[model samples]
Target: MNREAIDILVHSAWKLLEAKDYLGARELYTQGLKLDPFDATLWNYRSNAHMKLQHPELAFTDAARGLQLLDDKLATTNLSPEDRNFSVFMKIDLLFRCLLAAENLDICQTALKYIDRLLTNSHLLSNEARQTILSKQKSLKLKIKTKRHAFARASDSLRLNLNDVLNLGTMRITKYPWNEFEPFNSENDIETELKEINIMLEPIAPKLLVVRM
Candidate 1:
């Protein structure tokens, strides 16, 4: 491995990352990877750059690769205590990045897997970060449950709306779309007439309300 050159690239990329120049950092990391693709640190940081750029799939892939590399190192090679601790730290961070990317991809199950794996190392985390992961696990469980329930009822003609989703976690049936109307085209303002009628009814409808007396 061309360690010296890779170190320079990694250092330069870190500076770019700190400056929020994600693309520049990505480019530098890519160059370093070309020299030494096995550098788990480079892959992890590049995964972070991919995430910052909103490329979830790329971020997840790179993070997975980084974790695999780190795992291999920890399994096969004996290292100093300091080195082992740092590698474990990197492994946990890669899992975190993978979890975030999976969530962005709407693969909640994958996110849960990564979160579960992370919690096993909870002792290494600060209280705040550990709490955040626990909260995320709770959310992922609810999300998975909601998704499964919704999917079971989904059909070719049935469309999902915000209320349909919001209703899943609660027992009470929600009044979705208090008024159901035929779908109206919005580009030409097809609902303008109905909107006007509704506005006109605003005054009369209240008058129709019965009093307890």
Candidate 2:
């Protein structure tokens, strides 16, 4: 890798990123990666570009590769505490992007697994970032749970009587003429009352009131 070229690429790519030129930054990042495929920072930045373009699968892939490279570097290299912490933070942030990029339940579950693993080692993160990740984790868990139960809830609703199934008790129609009949109840009750009234009027059907001139 040419150090001078990498410096130029990094500088220009960062400027492009700041300017929201995600495609331009991505191209530079890709060029950088060809020179140093093991560069985790390049991977992370490239992932960012992909995310901005809504290329979730590519973003997730790059982010995951970045994490692997970071872990390998941490194990073999004697990095300063600040540098190590920053790398870890970047990885966590990338994990969040991965979560956001998830397009389906399976992908979401996979992202959750990675997130939970990082969260379990919360000491690797700053307090503020840790809290943010925890809150997001909780929200994601709730979203997944809700999605999983949605069908069951829909089916359960099928068994429900929207009108009256809670046994909330019936209302009364004791207002004026309505009081002459029974209280307002179920539809079945109303139908029964109508049937009884029709039965009582069966004989009256033949009677007619006539007028003579």
lDDT of 1 by residue, 58-144 (tens): 787778878878988999666989999999999999999989988888778778888989999999999999999999999989988
List the pairs of residues colliding in candidate 1. none
Tell me each candidate's TM-score.
Answer: 0.71, 0.61
The alpha-carbon deviation from the true structure for residue 96 of candidate 2, after best TM-score superposition, in angstroms, is 3.5
List per-prediction Cα lDDT, in the order shown: 0.75, 0.65
- Candidate 1 residues lying further than 4 Å off, grouped into runs, are 155-213
Which candidate should be chosen as best, given lDDT against the real structure?
A: 1
Q: Write the per-residue lDDT of candidate 2 for residues 1-213, one digit (tens) a residue.
A: 376787799899999989999999999988887777767788788888988887775676677667766776778568998988887777766666655555322454565676787777787678987787778678778876775477456658587553343223221111111111212233466555654564465467522211111
Model 2 Cα RMSD, Å?
27.9
